[model samples]
Target: MKSSRQLSKIVNIFLHIIALVFTYFLLQGGSLIIESLPNRHTQTQLEDYLDKAQLDALDKSLDASNLEAETLSFNQQSVKTELKGLKDVLAIQQQNYKEMLASRYVTEDNQSNRQVEQIRQKIEQGRVAITEVTQKSNQLKQQLLQNQQTRNQIQQEIQDLKGEARKVLRQEQRSNTLKAFLIRLLFVLPLMAIAVFLFKRFRDSSYWPFVYGWGYFSLYAFFIELVPYFPSYGGYVRSIVGIVACFLVGRFLIHKLQDYLEKKREMEQRDEESRRSSLQNNERNLENSFEKIHKGICPSCDRKFVSPDNKYCVYCGLCIKRECQTCNTLQVSFNQFCFECGEPHREVQENEHSEEHAAEPNDGINSSPPTPSGV
Candidate 1:
């Protein structure tokens, strides 16, 4: 068993080196070749979005520059005309009041003077209001310029961020490519290679546990690593591979079920020896079971077995080699033991003794009668 383990280790190492070389040159390079065929949809869409963003940003910046120049100009023509009208009214009213003072009654002259003062104060208030509006308009123009600069800065920052994001995404993709390659080398390739090795060259080897376990792991790792890198076509390799795998598995199960049913139907018609060989109930089946030898099938349960040392069947826990009770020699069947000495195992010896006893009865009376006749 130790020697068998050593052999399994050797095979595992040899196969691993082959697998590593195969994955590095074959699978990794193949993936790169597949990548070169065409850009995926997401990548194309991303590039389109970036191009659109640049064009849009350029157009908006040009529009903002034009608007920024226009925002500083405030029309003061209307305010100046109104102020001039107020000034003419005030000057004309003062000349009328002076003419009235020269040729009117005393009370009328006093009233005219008060009216002139009121008109002058109203004209001054109108001038102050116009001045306040001009100051507020100037302040608003400055704020607009600041806002325009802010918008432009924001647009530039957005473009910069997008560029940075694209760079990061490219870096991430390169890192992931290498990561997937390494994962295949460390996980997928070795499992697949060992599985192929066991299924081909080491089918009957004693390290069945590794063979069976590694086979399952190979299939599992293939999927875990494969689904992430599915190609661009809709439902392409993934769907096709899934359908094929399911079909093969379903066909295999159907055949196995049919074979089992046929064997069962024939079991009723078979003779005792035939039934014993076909059935698992008899002890002789420990060696003489006539089922097919699969990759790592158990003799008792007829299932896939994972026995590393081949001493015990993994499915049914049946001992592959029974120890001889008489001489402790290891053998397969209960029918034979210790071929060197021809000694039966304890269980077989009991049966033999019982058969011998049953063939003859106690003969004490017959023994005495025979002795007398001889005399």
Candidate 2:
């Protein structure tokens, strides 16, 4: 019997495990279905919320300014190169004129003087060219500085615009997140409602495994899927949700406990015969009775026995044990046969009932002595 009980327990455990596995697959499938719902919020890009035309125009202006700056930079480089070449040419011309003046061919001939004048003229022309090139370089530097300042201002404006656009994007994203959360909630709420109805009405039905599986899925969907998306006012929302759930569950348990106590009290008020008859007619299965008996409790009233050998329940007066008439051996009263004599106890009980009926006097008001047939 103990081995049988153990086997039953093992089978019950496997049923629960199978139920959990079934719930796992159901949750997986449900998650896939929930995920299939279109999410427009997640597809949103930052650029989607920005003023595209304004940004594009700004970018174009910035690019054009950069191109112009590059051209100016190249021109500056050319100016520097030209100035260097002019300076080199001026130095060579001065050296050549100095050498010609110191040469023995410098006798004051008219041709020599003419050549000296021509050298002076060439030196003056080179100085004027150098001055003009220097002026051009200075102007280029000024223009480059202005261009740099303009680019800096434009970049700052672009950054400011982008910053504002980012703020708007974040706001929109948060709003969209709320909308999406509501949509998912709407989708899941009906499922949770159905699961709750099934749990309340049919959880103990024959298809309890499926009901439990659905209950687990609904709980997971609500707690895991929906709760995280709850708009948190510094966690107040989640706390409130938790408190409400706890209160509901606690209230249900309290009510169930009250109902059980009330029913027990009503049952205890019944007469012994009625109580015994009720027990025989509505008794739990042998397995439950054995468990209660093992725990030293009266199977009829569910009250603890004063001693293991007690013949009847002290509270309910339901028979627990009695001696067999055939073998004078004590055994459980509910058993149909005695262990020692293998005598059927029901026969003895029937004989005893017959004898009690025989001993009772007639009390009916309409009773009369019967006349002899000859009279």
Candidate 3:
């Protein structure tokens, strides 16, 4: 279980790392595509085309001048009067050609110059455009680079976040697992120890509750891991259910153990009480036997063991009572009172004199029965 848990944690870390790497590459690939867009080459091609156009215009201008020079160089003037009209016609034609050439050349030059100027302007505009494009591209590149750097930083931060989150999660999981383990150990180990103690002390089966509690707590551990998969309210429901389940199971086991212990204690109490009662009964029986051996007459109870030869209880006092032998009803031997009857010696003497006098009078007149002995 320990190894599997460790492996699972390692695997989770690996997966997070892979996810971060994948995200980084995706961002980089997008930046590269943006940087490689086709606008720069297109602008360069337009500049090249304008250069060719300017060159073609200059060539056409040179070709027109060569044709005009050839036409002028072929003119010959002679034959004075006859040649005059030919010369005038040739001159007119030549002038017309010169005018045509000049007009054409001027038109061509003007057009070429205008075209060259336009091309120059275009070139200038193109340069500015290229500079703007370059600036924009550079800015974009810089932005992309910065974005990449930021992405890298963010990726690092994300990695750190994931690491921290995973660490915290793992730590929490470990804590929970450790707590579960400790709870199980606390529940099971102590019960097992108790079972062993009971077996040693009372020699009975008492480990069943521990087994049941272990099974229940193990199930609780598994159920806790499932809490995140459920809906929001499901956690509360599961928590309540778990609490109730734990409570029921714990209560049941504890109640059973308590009941078992109570029964055992009751049995012990009953055994102790019965043993005490038996001892008391034996003592009572022994006392009865001794009474029987003495012919149902304990002199101590009958006040018949008062003798000068005994000092403590011989039958009960195991000694002689120091009293007058004539007074068999136990008399006081010390001071003025009888120890057995709580009567003063002077009162007993007075009663005896009164009895003697009453008995003498009774002799003269239907004497009252002799007063009961010891009155």
lDDT of 3 by residue, 1-375 (tens): 011356755865665465455445543553464334322112222223233454455455545544543443332111133334444554554455445555656677655555455545544554555455455545545554554555465456545545665666655554554444444444345535644454455432233333333333333323432233222243675588679979999998999999976754553344322322222244343344334224533222233344434333343332122443344454322223555555565324544665778655322211222122333
Against the unseen true structure, what C-alpha lDDT does each candidate score? 0.55, 0.77, 0.43
Arrange candidates, best TM-score first: 2, 1, 3
Q: Which ten residues in a row have the lowest lDDT in candidate 2?
A: 365-374
User: Which residue pairs in candidate 1 collide?
Assistant: none
Task: State every prediction's TM-score relative to the real structure.
Answer: 0.39, 0.60, 0.26
Misplaced by over 4 Å in model 3 are 1-111, 197-375
Model 1, 2: alpha-carbon shift in Å? 20
TM-score of 3: 0.26
Error at 256, model 1, angstroms: 2.2
Candidate 3, number of clashes = 13
Number of the predicted model whose TM-score against the real structure is largest: 2
Query: Which has the greatest lDDT?
Result: 2
lDDT of 1 by residue, 1-375 (tens): 122356766976766565455544554555564454332332422354355666567767767765664654433344445556655665676666566656556566676776666756665675666567666656666676776787677667667757876886776555555455554546556667878888777654665544555565566556645445554245676689689989999998999999986765555444433332344344335334523233455444556556534645544444444455566565543334567568765435544665789767543432211111112
Off by over 4 Å in 2: 1-41, 97-112, 193-202, 232-375
Instruction: Please state the error at residue 274 of candidate 1 in Å.
Output: 3.3
